[model samples]
Target: MSTTISRLLVANRGEIAARIIRTCRTLGIETVAVYSDADRDAAFVQLADVSVAIGGEAPADSYLRSDVIVAAATQAGADAVHPGYGFLSENAEFAQSVIDAGLVFVGPRPQTIAAMGSKIEAKRLMADAGVPVLPSAELDGLDDAAVQAAIDGVGYPAMIKASAGGGGRGMRIVSDPSDVLEAVAGARREADAAFGDGTLFAERYVAPSRYVEVQIFGDHDGNVVHFHERECSLQRRHQKVIEEAPSPSLDPTTRTALHEAAVRAGSALGYVNAGTVEFLLAPAVGAGSPEFFFLEVNTRLQVEHPVTEAILGVDLVALQLAVASGGALPDQAAIGAPRGHAIEARLYAEDPAAGFRPSIGELRSFAIGGPAHAAVRVDSGLAGGGVVSRHYDPMVAKVIAHAGSRDGAARQLAGALRQATIDGLVTNRALLVRTLQHPEFLDGRADSAFFERNDPAALGAPLVDGPDVAWYAAAAALAVQAYRRSTDRHTAGVSSGFRTVPTGPQRIALVDPAGHEHRVSYRF
Candidate 1:
């Protein structure tokens, strides 16, 4: 049976919600946005055709409450519900709940999500399907001695990860055998808090591996097509900061194999809608073929899908809607070859110099370029006066630049980020700019440990006010003094701080954004 949706309710918030709303508008479908109290005036809430207040600010009280979201969708007369990325986006139970409520869930089947939900199960399934998977062990059934044995079997520098949740939660790297138990415990706690499941697993950690993920789409008929790949090797804290399309590290043969493997993965599960299959590509040595191992499946649209969209010249959201509605995907040949290159930088409210700590405060000023011939495209859920509280992800905007070449794309994006005016809270804008210009990144050799290898201070150095900045401060102070002199009653007709001839030096104190005061001296 074909499922048709007229009005859709987006069961999430922030930029992804806004992103879905934009696509829905293009398709002439009305959108319903659910928001917490914290996002009452958020951009997505304002942009949606209708909006509902779900609950309090915390995710559990609001976004994670599946029943409440379903009720909101029903009340809003939405025929379908789209869980944008994050929150309940990859949740199998939530997807089932929506299906049970007779609303079309705009994503893969609940079974598909369940299959790929756990890292262990997904890897086993992929391995069974002739897909290469990293060696891993399920620790739930293993004793302490057995766990240590398994770790030793997998070798050192293995990763203990929470199989239930992603986003780097409940994850730890165990280099020493003595640290295994503590790492497992910590990962389980974090996993439980983040995903309500504390199931842990261990995987062989491959160093100097490139993180590349293929965007895939499947129809109800079992037809699946791959939408090329994205290079996401540049990351910090296990989260992607910068991503680009058409991995520079992959040759045509490897690229074709990657695409075929991704298609096999999707078809094996009867996958439907949009999903991503991430892989770790070890560089080829001495002209040998590169080795790629299955990482995990993100059973929903990825944050870095825009780069794929840019290169492929297709709207993935549109495809998601079509596939979710029981429509067929275009023929493989019609998808066309990828062209040029695209790069995306996630701008966050954080201080990279201070260990990338989240910065929360009002955005006194926010300015970015709109779409132009060759300009950057900014996707943001924030406005100039928006308050970036600690309630959600600190990402303020996603700036993407498309060009005819990889270097061109990187340069354009970096220039755009450097030109952006973001005030109030400290941001990682300068860090992103520096990363795009870094030689390692430019040469496409950046690995998962890129941040660990580079100096955070150097990355955020551009954000530092240089010595010449004092001149601007002094000039601003002088301008203010001039204005006061022009407005004062006693000094109305006289130029204050001005003598017929030059006199003693005048000292003007200016406060920097970091609250440092600089005294400028000048003789007039």
Candidate 2:
């Protein structure tokens, strides 16, 4: 409450930055955007009232440079800083810097970020606060003897997670004791690359696990409320592909218990603004019956916030602004009433069938055709034809569907995806549609193993261009030949374009991704 916060600085890029910008504009708050050299002309930059060029192309020189961001905020005369997901959002040091600079950090307190930024520290804090935690122990002198002793106790399937890493980095699953050392070394190297810390810990690799996370909000007035859970089961690597509100597997009693746990955890931290409590749920495991154990706290808005917004009709970004500015949380009984079902599909410009390799190119054409009802909404940061660069994440847009039931919402999302078209860049849109329509998915039986169990090529349309179009092109070529050849003796080389009834043969070569050519030959 010490600062008035009339102006705010968005300290990230892409769709999330634009998302927060929209909310700020609605609140009559002036917005300032910080951009790297590459993102100087990004949509979020244009949408902001003002923009600052912080550094060069690299994230470290730009987005991750806390000092640069703080200086930019100071120069822009912004009263608050909103680190929209990723980058420096979870860095407690960055939060502290913003505070020292006399600007409100529109997120959890610095202490909360520090406590949760490190997975080891967060686990210990949760255990100390009586939150349900998984079976795990920190590794300190992880030599051969130590590894053997710990692995024997933790069992065959264990996870080696980075003490100071997240977002899918620095984590490896060891199904056999023999692979522990190698996996641990790889995890340590990845952790060093990401967090400058190579330290790791061992934890029971929860089986049949679902990434269930709770949305919670707190204010300076000490009031906190839970907005239900999201089931992020369908993920590639550790990136979430599909997310739904109110996890399908949870019963009424379990849902209440989970919410209570989240509230208690948040109250324990004196958390403020918007945050998510992630849990590793090994449903039907002994000791815990389809229950969730505390994983970590994301002390900022999550990328999948729209699902919660759709189900609860709450604008979390706005809530963050209000809470950061000393406003009290809304009446819990009235605000926590979640209705309807919401589903979100992240339409990334990646080729899932191609080892999920990142595809970067110009979007020749992009259009999303969906139901014109209020229940359907498509949030995007790109125009019809924007360039997708390797410099950033491949996500172009998020398509969300809201309905009265899970099946309805899911079907709505599939139909919307089917009508979408993008010409140039390779995307997993078709794959998403296939996943949504898969029999197992429709029946709510999809798990993390679903993709591996199914055929990748069959997961989407076989060709980048629809099967019908390819066949249509071929049929059109055949028809042209059929019309000219009266005897119907036309072959690949003896095409309809043989104006003088050619005596020789001609071949047309078409190259494919595998560097092979298919030659169509005909003789006239």
Candidate 3:
């Protein structure tokens, strides 16, 4: 039954919504965009064929309102809905609501989502399917002594994780026995607040490990295939920052084993559409083979999906739409070996030196220039004069580069980022450039603890400092004066800085991204 989706509604906002609209255009599907008050005039909203205001500014009032989103889809006459990687994407109830409304949901079935939504249940399911998983115990209704006993059984340095959600929320790392009960209670409260489910579980925490995941896709025909792996070891606050394909740290044997394990896991769940099987890889030690453990399965597309698409040379969103329409999966042989290496850096509007605090303001300038060869790609929803709202995630863009070699890709990406014209908001662009060019990262020795070992303030320091600031400030002041002179009605024919009487050099004070002030004095 190959039913076509003539019209599709994107139930999210920002760059991901724009990304989905692009694919829908390519597939000849009419697109509808649903937005909140904050995104009423956003780029994604303008890009869609039709736009609808779902509710107010907050996520709960807009993007997370499944009923409103479904109503908008019906009102817009859209046949399907695409939850683009964020709010309500993994909510099984939301998915069921879409299905119940006689609309196609562009993701896995509700049952599969529910099964994998809980980390405890997902691990049990993986273990039963013969997938390697870390030792863990469920702590939903356990007493104080039982909880401590479970933590002791899982060993020291155990991680208490929220069973119902991801994104590093409701998680605590416990090393001391005295902190077990407190950590558990706090995690429970956070989980309840974040996901409305306080159920939790304990698992052994792995340190100095590489975070790798396999991109898997399944179709309605019960076929699943792996699109190799991505190395996402570089992180902050348990969130991925930089990701690359064909992990530089994995040996050939380990890579093959990981792909097979991911395929097995997906098959066990009968997973459909795009999903990622994440794993924690412990590097080989003294002639021993590297060991990998199934971390969890993200039952929806991941944020770092662009790196996989670049290496595989496929549009995952297109494939997702195709499968959602009851199409068959592409043959494994057709989706051949990876062509080259690709790396993606998340350019976020945050001050890394200031504890990664989100920075919000108008994007006075936002341009990313790359080589003429066109190996670089930037996926962003912002442009010059756009506002970065405080109501949503502060990620400004994702910059990706592909090259014949890993080093080439890193260097090319670094050059592109270094020469970018991003202004106004404080961002982690400098830190991304530093990580790409750092010796340890190039040698593939960097792990999830990379930030812990290297201070972000040092890594995110401005590329130019000292006297360069004075020169930049002087140039800015000159430009401002020139513009004023051009627009001034009183100084019709006068040149900039023209004065009838002798005077001291005009001074101007400016502030830099790091909150430092510089004074500039220039005569002409």
Candidate 4:
């Protein structure tokens, strides 16, 4: 294959940028990085072969600004641009600009992007391709009168979604007819804020549905293949919190049909590189199998890519680069079915008890490597010394545990999370651990609406007596005090002067995000 580009400019920040850079380096491609003022000292910037400052911290002024990104690429003298998800990854105009500037976009054509970028338009396209989709209503006109007319056609309990937006930023659900206007307005505001497009669409809010998505890869020659499905049913606020490969709910027949549906959807757009075909799966009714419908196509590598990679034993990021360089996808016949079971839990720097709000703080201490009992794999963006910032998504890492069976996978994931420790910035690790242990989840009875109905505090922090993880900090603090006392008496530091902190007869006060403190004493 002839190479059109040797240097690639990554037009995003944080972990995704770092991910792309790693692949580019392995392929002998020089890389350039862009960062904002807030991320001037970011790890990605320092690691890149070349780095450029874009603008201020907020995504709008920096990463999302097309001009800044393109200018950075040009100034960095890169021949290709890779939009590493979240910022400009799915923006058709951004893709067009890269092509117009004579730089390889490392993705699909601009027209293809424009086609699938809209939720309503994409649904229509998929439906034409014989892919089932949920009920939809396009906001043909933005006026109140037109919305009312559209709602009457789509029916009640519909979601108002931003056609060009993602990450659950511009969406609202109206269970009652009276709240349609408020939903439309709020959705538009969020859409405009997030994607600079206020065009909204309506789709039926399917109840008891699971978020099942298939990873897809296509080349310029029109060849397409499915990388199987990942169950992203576990979500919070429409954002996926946990994902697993080879959906346990799908049988062989359903899996084949689902994969075929995803391939057809990808073929419709002439998609290239890696993208995900999100579908909504409704529960079985009466005697029939469950019905699945195309939801939306994520036009970039997903945050949950690790789960897919873990089960398939392939590096998707590397594959993406290969596709961009005009290389053929790994032979469809060469790829086997997913091996074993894989589960992923996103570790977010947020307080689960306080409504799972975003948190920002410097990490004081951290440890993630386990004893290899569960085939644990951690794809993280932070080292122990990094800071969790408010300027980006709160997800710090994705911990995946692979095993021979679903039950083993679940238990292994829980074990990995339990053994993991982070000192600074409250996280949802405990909640994820609890969800892994949740009866409904373990039995595969949970769906996309599971978190919406369950209490947030209950998922990560179960009511059961958890191993006092925080107790270690207090014991260590007290142990240090004891060691100092010994040193004070001896007037010298010695190995014998240190005493291991015991869990017996220790008490400490722990504070919740709400400023409520509880005294937790320990007894050994």
Task: Show model 3 residue runs off by greater than 4 Å.
Answer: 370-373, 486-494
The sequence of per-residue lDDT tens digits that candidate 2 reaches over residues 254-307 is 788888888888999988889999887666657555867888888889888999
**Could you give candidate 1's per-residue lDDT for residues 386-417 as a string of tens digits?**
87868899999988989999999988898888
Q: Tell me the TM-score of each prediction against the true structure.
A: 0.93, 0.89, 0.97, 0.89
lDDT against true structure, model 3: 0.91
lDDT of each residue in 315-410, candidate 4, tens digit only: 887787778879888767777888998999888988878888887878766667567653587665565558887888887887888888889999
lDDT, candidate 2, at 448? 68
Candidate 2 lDDT: 0.82
Q: What is the lDDT of residue 230 in candidate 3?
A: 96
Clashing pairs in 4: 430-460, 431-460, 504-524
Give lDDT tens digits, candidate 3, residues 389-420.
99999989999999999999999999999888
- Cα displacement (angstroms), candidate 2, residue 407, comes to 1.2
- Candidate ranking (lDDT, best to worst): 3, 1, 2, 4
Worst 10 residues of 3 by lDDT: 366-375
Candidate 3: give the clashing pairs: none
Superior candidate under lDDT, 1 versus 3: 3
lDDT of 4: 0.82
- TM for candidate 1 is 0.93
Q: Who wins the lDDT comparison? A: 3
| Sliding window of 10 residues with minimal summed lDDT for model 1 | 368-377
What is the Cα-based TM-score of model 2?
0.89
